[model samples]
Target: MGASQTQLRETLDRLGLTVPLADALWVLDPAQPAPSMKTLAGQLHCDPSSATFLVTRLELQGLTERVPDPADRRSKTVELTDKGALVRGELIEAMVAQSPLAALGPEDQAAALQLLRRALAQAERP
Candidate 1:
């Protein structure tokens, strides 16, 4: 797991992303309501301050923006700009290209994805 994580970190770094910021960006959905800072923190499994720091870096890069939540003006949500979405798409493509699974046939890749998703879903359960 550590080796895989290291490889992913290197891949993301080469694409101009830190792991935390990349993780944060990956969670954003431009078509949906933006997630609050607290929700982002929860998704990242990090503290609010850490999430804020990551989001701030992305904001500085012009990839993300903070907007006031409509339901609660006191709270803010992080959103990806068009630029951010482009970067995210590039990141996804890069990751897929670098993936060991890329060597597999299409059917094998589908099977692998299904198995991986099932395992991930099970891991998420209490």
Candidate 2:
């Protein structure tokens, strides 16, 4: 999550976004079709109530909204607004450009990843 933290810092400073809302951007994609509350719960690995709460919070901020699901009129789907899309793009770009390994070449990145994975595995030992 180092990369995420790095990106979050920049985007938060630039956009004046709350930490929770910015973190939720990880699963929110503008290019994708709107996802139902159930689908978002699955993606966030939380209960339906938690997902609803998160969606509500984002909606309050004008970052997301609940719309009628095309496939099921009774159900609602979540989608980003224009402002949300812009913020998402900025978050994505910052994440990429400010990654811990951004300065590394492909080969060096791969090599570093291997070493990091090895260290992580060793650290996981009980």
lDDT of 2 by residue, 3-100 (tens): 56755676777776666567666688877788899998888888889889888888887888999999999999999988888878887788778787
lDDT of 2 at 75: 100
TM-score of each: 0.86, 0.75
What's the number of clashes in each of the models? 0, 0
- Model-by-model lDDT, in order? 0.86, 0.82
* Highest TM-score scorer: 1
Candidate 1 lDDT over 67-115, as tens digits, reads 9999999999899998999988887776677678888999999999999
Each candidate: RMSD to true structure? 2.0, 4.5
* TM-score, structure 2 vs. true: 0.75
Clashing pairs in 2: none
